[model samples]
Target: MNKITTNAFHPMQLKISQADIGYKEILISGADAQLQSGEVCLLIGNNGVGKTTLIRSVLHQIAILRGTITLGDKNIQELSVKEIAEYIAVVLSKSAIPQNYTVNDLVSLGKYIHYPFYFELSKEDQKEVRETIENLGLQQYDATPLKNLSDGNLQKAFIGRALTQNSPVIILDEPTTHLDEKNKIIILKTLRKLAREHHKLILFSSHDWRLAKEFADKIWYIKDRTLHAGMVEDVLIRHHELTDPSLFNVNEYFKAPHIIAPPLYKEMLYSLLQKNSTADLSHLSFEFMDNRWHIDAKGNGYQCGSFEEILVLVKTLH
Candidate 1:
């Protein structure tokens, strides 16, 4: 067995070559990607675009049709399941936890890689588990049953377990799936911290474009048989396919509201235009000093909370 480095600051990378990724047929082909240590990359795509398939291929759960995946100094195909566990920790999208299990129970189970079949957890392991639970804000639910917990809290518990596992690489499939706005930010922020502060490789699939775009250092967009990757700003600006907004005839259809929002609301503005299907967003202008939105328009802007409120605002604008 080859000795692996324990240094967190070491240059660790996951490289993928031209591979066909999917089940039965290729959903994406000739894909290439790489992630270095201390980088947080978000994978974004619509449904059935093989995002999960690519993830499975990296985890070695699914066979690569034709390609190579190298992790650090070793090829992924050459590593055993146990050996791979030493390098990566994964938070699954739909794992079934036992209804009877407690938050602590689930987290303690992460140590089974080191102490398989041992019912007792070592003091060091217990300490790590406690710290992970506390860090994820799961301490209050430490004794709560899995069945009784909210979906967001349950998701956090799963994340805490993955953190306690202590692997250099972490992959999460929609870690913020059931989480509300606040909890979603918490998880994404934690992932970024893990990558930068702890030198962990963080890769995750996310549907919350705003949250992902806000926190991710880079983006890996899977679309049209390609995996586009780069710094978030570069990817957003360079890749037209990822930014192709939904065309809406809002001005011709419904009552369109005037929006004096910041320029960063590109995606949101596009969506609002489509949702209202009556406003023209192409002529929309915005300004922001920092991340906060401030529109520099000639009219008194009416802040709307929903699409219905937008209709009323449009009437007042006229």
Candidate 2:
């Protein structure tokens, strides 16, 4: 069993060493990693690379098969569930929380870790909960039931709960899973703010590499039965494909119709990490407006129902 030292003082680092990522059979082992205060870490890997296992181990929901996991100076296995709750808060996909709980009520559960059973909220705690809800843009839904909010809004409420917990470390599994581009930015920006302003260590797993590259202090890449960690630049250097992006063609810079283009669509098109379409260089201009695909080819306009359509149309002009 893991033990929590009574030291209880905050350390500058959360460290893991020689930890086994899975049970029954070890999925990955001898994994060593650390995250510091004021840092947002992105954990990324293939579907079965044990990223979730690593996170669950760190959160103490599951024991590591071997080695040590520590938050600050104390080993994580030693910490009791309550003590661990104070150190880390988590947001997971597919939660089964009660439908009747209001958004505020859901967020307030984060404070439960700090209080005794049947605990009443202090004025300070109330203020913190309210502030976190507002910060997540959940004020309009504060009094609304969780069942009533859209999936996006509900996701924000869960995140706000994690924020309200006031833990030094926060872990999230696919925090942006169902979000649109705007809400994805909102969630990640909030994480960076928490890391920089509040000095919280944010560990999150995401498939959104572009946003992670923009905001994460470190990228933790788990792959091929190994764990790799470094600042975004260094790690990205190792993974060259992420930087060598081609969202569209390389031959020309066709003007995107401005009305439906996402913010900085041109930059995004040029900086895309991959391309699924090959556009003809002549008589065809791609328009990325309104988060959808459209094309003006030889002065003929067409709106694509999907990206595949755009790809098909682009090839038509080829």
TM-score of 1: 0.81
Residue-by-residue lDDT tens digits, candidate 2, 80-110: 8877888788998778777689999999999
TM of each candidate vs. truth: 0.81, 0.75
Candidate 2: which stretches are off by over 4 Å? 1-10, 244-318
RMSD of each: 5.0, 7.8
Candidate 2 TM-score, C-alpha based: 0.75
Expressed as tens digits, the lDDT of each residue in 148-205 for candidate 1 is: 9999999998888788887889999989999988888888888889988998999999
lDDT of each: 0.77, 0.78
Indicate which candidate wins on lDDT.
Answer: 2
Candidate 2: clashing residue pairs, number: 10
